[model samples]
Target: METSDNATAAEETTPEPERTGIAAQDWATASAVPQYRAAVVDLLGALAYGELAAFERLADDAKLAPSLEDKAELAKMASAEFHHFERLRDRLAQIDAEPTAAMEPFAKALDDFHHQTAPSDWLEGLVKAYVGDSIASDFYREVANHLDSDTRSLVLSVLDDTGHGNFAVEKVRAAIEADPRVGGRLALWARRLMGEALSQAQRVVAERDALSTMLVGGVDGVAAGFDLAAVGEMFTRITKAHTKRMAALGLAA
Candidate 1:
């Protein structure tokens, strides 16, 4: 009877392995380090919510589509965004975190970004999908590099551009070809998107201590943190990438 009791007690006492997509050893290492764990949770939370919001926005954009084909494409993209969100949500759960709670902190900032940059037309939606999302993806990639290998891989994978790239580029470029003046208008709109994105991003950094620290705190001591010089250089690289993306769309930066 005592042996039976001991066996059951042992089973109860042994901790369950975490269910995150990353390796168990990696999860253990991240959990052992306070800053690393907090940063990872904060980053994943923000990204998961971002994808969920993107899914909704893309679905809304589908309603404004000019044709059945375009609406179908938008719906497909929205579905992909939801898949990404599911992956992130599962990853969060594996770590015993509440997916909705993790997502709550970022809701306002991301919603504000979309609200402030609401597209005026189908063309604007396409451009915003490509340009605005690309910038956000670039920033996420930059931060992912600072994470552990498994976590970094998961982050990059979820950040995948999906299947809308060539579609947006081709459509926007064709529109520019049809009306040269549209390029000028889009260029201005793109600039506004960039500006608003930067504003909201700065606000996010200012408000989220763990995330902002992750930017400058050097998670796991793997990459440079956010100092003034570092921040300036970061924006410089983002600007260069933005310019290239605009050029691809046949618009001025």
Candidate 2:
């Protein structure tokens, strides 16, 4: 999982912040706009449900672990994911939004994504947890740039690594080295995850009008907006990060 200095630099560099046109504002200022409030609720709801789902998936995947040590590691990560879900749920309630109602709209889409991409073995499960979760985290971090400062901090906090990244990289690279053919299978699996993950994201945005509008048109006068071209660039950045992650796992992207 060694990252070259060049790769680290590239990872650190992002498109200019000015392009987002979003000025930093607190939740009080940003949420005063009804549309913005609704958008924030929807965003939090989707995130809350995603974290909950991650907790469940990690716990279930732990059963497929080849050793007790691996099982324990995943259990710890699962607990962390649940805590993240709790934070998002509490945040929604604190804002006077009903957590269940906010999350309901996202349930089917997220559930379908998991059902479709269920991993077949321990290594595949590890790849799913690492690759799938990282993609979602990257997308959220990009969107966080447009959010009010308070919400942005909460979003970023919940997206923290939870120590799974290095664990997955170590185990997956070792598995590949022990049997090089595993690399081909995992590389393909990672690609499938990339495609499904991106599609699920697009589906969510298309179905959620307030959230989509928030991204495309900006919320109220407080936030700047993303043009269609900017959205394209966002996905490009996500794709590049995915490639780097694949490389870290000793797989071809």
Candidate 3:
């Protein structure tokens, strides 16, 4: 996986998606295709619903930010999540599928993931959005290569435009460094968030392997087979990114 450190990459990626409204039937598929049972479908539903809630909740939380600068940036990011959620929901519909109901089975476990790991402060919120969303975007970007073209395009589109979330990365790190005391508290909070995330993921497997099986399909190795490790690695990178943010802020990692 190649990583770019330049802001130009950020600039190149964030073209405003022209807001042509979703097609009349974009939210529902026409033919009753069998692909509905695939782990892929279930995963999409889980991801779709999560994005819907994340967008709303994050938008609300942005109000908690101290400055209009932070508030505006975070709100933009939250709105983008809503765009992504709708794109996914519309794509699900085009498959002639039930978006919310398909998403229902995995809802509780996924909701539990967010509820248990909710952030407590402004910097933490930025880290959660920057680190968390970017990691998920990367992993989904990778997984998209395995899917059919339309689904792949839909996934790629949703993952495409993260307008300088890396900027937030730089800002948060600077904030933490400017005040060394926040380092331990935010770092500890980051770990707690990751732990709750992992625990909820395991519970998903223990209780809802149907969705789990649908998520990974037949990836390859035992560790990769129906395991949450891929998602965990995403979270691991989130922590690594958080470390970079902290260090940039002049705080100890």
Candidate 4:
């Protein structure tokens, strides 16, 4: 009888499975660490602002569309981008972070990036939508690898293609086929966008201590072994992805 009682007690006291990676833990488990919480807030804030900016930019870019069909497609993508922004904003508030205040720090940087990389025409707009936005998405997806499961899921969901990539690819490829000279111009534009996007990303990391620490030193068990070497490798991967995107668009990387 005593042995049976002991066995029951042992089973009742059994520990939960150990969480081996950020993906194994939910936001409630991972956000217990102050630094990790701060890092997540910063990450979400930046992403929220980026989505909002993309929404606005795509709407404006629609004005440059060569046809009403193209304009309507861009409008649809802009709505999707706005929906993404709302998700991030709601998540921030659910975590008790002020949505606008959290997003404020990143607003200027994202605004400047858009201002600097403003596309001149319909084809340039298509290329920027495909190439520039994909670069940013790739970077965020890399960062998402270190996020807690809940946050990671939200981030990945919002990053889903809003049919923009295929739409941009079809339009840009058709333009290039129609005029090979357009391919060279767009390729040069894409390269410029890559440089600016990387610079903006580095600037954001440098300015946000919590985010930079999360990337370099990591927090809690997330990105536990991440280092400078890993950062270099991440960028190399992003560049390789960019080259493939350019190739798909019938442009030189």
Q: Write the per-residue lDDT of candidate 3 for residues 110-177, one digit (tens) a residue.
A: 67766766777777776565545544454455454444445656776676555646655577667766
What tens-digit string does per-residue lDDT give for candidate 4 at 1-253? 0011211222235464344555478999888888788888999999999999989989999999888998998899999999999999999999999999999999999899989998889888877877777878877876777778899889878987788887877788888888888888898999999999988888887787777767654776544543658778778877877777777788888
> Number of clashes in model 2?
0
Q: Flag clash pairs in model 1.
A: 216-225, 216-226
Task: Give candidate 3 regions above 4 Å deviation.
Answer: 1-37, 202-253
Every candidate's lDDT: 0.75, 0.83, 0.57, 0.80
By summed lDDT, the worst window of 10 consecutive residues in model 1 runs over 1-10
User: For this target, which candidate reaches the highest lDDT against the unseen true structure?
Assistant: 2
lDDT (10s digit) by residue, model 2, range 1-253: 1122222323477554653333377888878788778888999999999999999999999999999999999999999999999999999999999999999999998899999999999999989888888888877777777788799889978987788888888999899989999999999999999999999998887777667767664765645543567777778888898888888889899
Higher-lDDT candidate of 1 and 3: 1
Estimated TM-score for each candidate: 0.86, 0.91, 0.70, 0.89
The clash count of every prediction, one per candidate, is 2, 0, 10, 0
- Which residue pairs collide, candidate 2? none
C-alpha-based local distance difference test score of model 2: 0.83
Over 4 Å off, model 2: 1-11, 15-23, 222-226
Candidate 3: RMSD to truth: 7.8
lDDT of 3 at 67: 82
Encode model 1's per-residue lDDT on 159-233: one tens digit a residue: 765767667888888988988989999999999998888777777766766677666545553444457666666
Decreasing lDDT order of the candidates: 2, 4, 1, 3
Ranking by TM-score: 2, 4, 1, 3
